[model samples]
Target: MESPDRTVHVAYDPYVIPGGRTIHGRADGLNGEWSVHLGRQTSVEIVAGLTDGLTRPRSAHAPNV
Candidate 1:
């Protein structure tokens, strides 16, 4: 994890919903399971110009799409 001040390991918890995916704590209105991409590029995009944002490190318990 790279921060503006420094870098550290950050943990994020994500879940799925009907409309779009969510980033647990930082963001809530994000696209849920429907837009989650498994092995391909997804429609979801993180905050622009910001290095710290939602990223798929692993499967979010399978994409509902």
Candidate 2:
């Protein structure tokens, strides 16, 4: 089992805007596809929505959500 204290990463496609780079839409309800040895909850879900990032749209360099 994985510890809740540990954080997991999620990624999605990025889009270009008139101002800068950002996600075209919300990345919510996608955590269900994540798996980090979360034994009891192999398919745990998040009730919140993810914000759009300009620089790092992918999970590689995400700052604060």
Q: Which candidate is the best by TM-score?
A: 1
TM-score against truth, every candidate:
0.17, 0.15
Cα lDDT tens digits, model 2, 1-65, are 11232333433323322222122322346543332112222222321133222222468665555
The stretch of ten residues in a row with the least summed lDDT in candidate 2 is 35-44
- Alpha carbon lDDT of each predicted model: 0.32, 0.30
Model 1 over residues 4-59: C-alpha lDDT tens digits? 33232232324432323222223235633322222222233343212243343336
Q: Which regions of candidate 2 are displaced past 4 Å? A: 1-35, 46-56, 59-61
> Once superposed on the true structure, which residue ranges of model 1 sit more than 4 Å away at CA?
1-17, 26-42, 47-51, 54-65
TM-score of 2: 0.15
Which predicted model would earn the best lDDT? 1
